[model samples]
Target chain A: MGPLFPQEIIGEELNILIGFFIGIGFGFLLEAAGFTNTRKLAGVFYGYDFVVLKVFFSAAITSAIGLFIMNQYGIIDMSAIFYPKTFWIPTLVGGLIMAFGFIIGGFCPGTSMCAAVTGKIDAMVFIGGALIGVFFYAYTYEPLWKELRDSGAMGKVNIAEWMGIDSGLFILILTLIAASAFYAVTIIQKKVTAKGDYQI
Target chain B: MERSKKYMNPYLAGILIGVFMIAAYYFSGEGLGASGALKSVVVATTDMVAHDYATEHSYFSARVSDPENPPIKTWLVFEVLGVLVGAIISAAFAGRLKLETIKGPNVTTKTRFITAAIGGLLFGIGSQLGRGCTSGMVMSGMGVLSLSGFIGLMAIFGGGYVLAYFFRKLWI
Candidate 1:
């Protein structure tokens, strides 16, 4: 009954409309969580503020738990979704590249978009650069990136299944880990900020 | 100038976003994403300008080759459009809308802009290779217990921590 769009239980127009509303909520939460602030986002890595960690892990745990329960009750079919394949090699390399982007650019793609719309000048320039980059990639896809992009194909696998553990149990473990990390970050934040103020 | 309202509690905002994620999956059979829309928009724009070139290119062709379903006409694109709208509304109500460059006190506007441009360029390339950006790949993947999500999570933040010291002047 769930995943209404794929099943055609919902019309295409309706599904798109729903998606827009969801995006609005997503953007709102992102800005409200202070993710639009580069200083605040950077704080997670610098040990000054841990808001990013708190929000990220909290959201992940929440979604995992919610999905698990919904699947248990047959409320949604997890198999129907646009599941991602694992391109381990590319992901690793790409992730490192993105990491540098985060440090130097001061915003991720989503946050940059949100910040750009809210009148962040740097974010506007960042988006401009991204557009050029995307265009460049498309032009050079076959010659330069085709090989690396398609490398290391592990199809449709997840952590719980790979570990040979139940999804519910794995989520429980993840929640526990996140909880401890949340606690640990709080303590770390206090120590770091004690040395000097962190202004965002 | 009126100061911006205090941000919503981080955990609360996270929970609300998580709820939105669940809804996204339920309604559309996927999670939140940002980069996919970027790709779509680019492909569509390219196709609009030069239909033959876009449809012939290996990467753009995948979407642009389909005449009936143009690259821009998709759920992700609409969702991203809504992100812009929603961000505007939120910033408006919070009194946070202003034009300014965000940077460290020590950094010049020129240096920050140059870094920002380079950073964005790299991120665009990375997201294409990795198949998604932060929201789409790592976090949403993890929501479904995907291994790629965990690997990406580690690679991103782990790499960030490993490299943070070098970029200390950029933020701290």
Candidate 2:
């Protein structure tokens, strides 16, 4: 009944069409959550604004909970969908590099796309830089990056299974952690803003 | 500057985003992803400019050869197209739709732009190396309890906190 694309319940065009609509919602929510603002995103690290953290955790946990329950009830086939593979070494190194991008660029790939579309000049420039980066990678793959990117291949491991815990229980624990962090961040944001209100 | 409407509460926005994500899984059989388009654009553009090189390259060959899902016709490309439209609509509705450069007060426009370019360049390479960006890898991956996603989540955020002090002037 679900995963219409893989099940042949829908054609590729329809799948792509539906994806487009869903992306609209994603973009709308992103902008509505103040994600277009670099300052808002940067605030999470600086303790000045936690909208990024709050929205991010809430979205992730909510999707986790919702999808997990849906899977339990047999509404959607998790296996029929595209799931990302785990590459610990490269992921760690790449993620660290992206962290510098986040702090310096003030936007991740998604947020930057949305921001650039909505007319942020710096975002447009950032897109240019990303294009160049991708080109550089594509050209130099054989010599410079191929090996490192392909390292540490652990195939499709779920964290819950790896930890020897129930998926539901793991999600519950994650939710609690996110909730507590939300509470703590709210307080930190208050203290930081109270100290001095800076403009973004 | 013109005043814009206040943003929606973060919690509610998060809920809406979750609903959309679930819908994506239900219909398209994918979760939130936004960086694939960047790669696609690169592949397509490269294919056009240097067809021989693109076709021969290991990185771009598979994408270029796949007729059923050509580089430009990928799901993420359409999705990102919609993101652009949706973002434009939302920004317009919020009265925040305008062309401007955002930067910290302490830094000049030159420094800010240069920093942003370098950051974007690094992120582009990292995303390709890691197989996805924040949304495609970490956010959606973690939602499904994938170890890769969780690892990325910790790395990016943890790394950010560690480096924030050094780059404080950039933002603060």
lDDT of 1 at A158: 78
Q: Candidate 1: where is the Cα deviation over 4 Å?
A: none
Model 2, position B75, has a per-residue lDDT of 84
Residue-level error in angstroms, candidate 2, position B31: 1.8
Q: Give the TM-score of candidate 2.
A: 0.98
How do the residues A1-200 of candidate 1 rate in per-residue lDDT, one tens digit apiece? Answer: 78899999999999999999999999988988878777888888899988988899888888989988999999999999867789899999889888888888888899999999999999988888788778888889999888999999999997898999988889989999998998899999999999986766
Return the DockQ of model 1. Answer: 0.79
RMSD of each candidate?
1.2, 1.1
**In model 1, which residue pairs have backbone atoms overlapping below 3 Å?**
none
| lDDT of candidate 2 over B1-172, digit per residue (tens) | 3388888899999988888888888898887887789999999999889988888989989888877767998788888888888888899999888898888767888988998899899889888888899899998998888999999998899999999999999988
- Clash tally, candidates in order: 0, 0
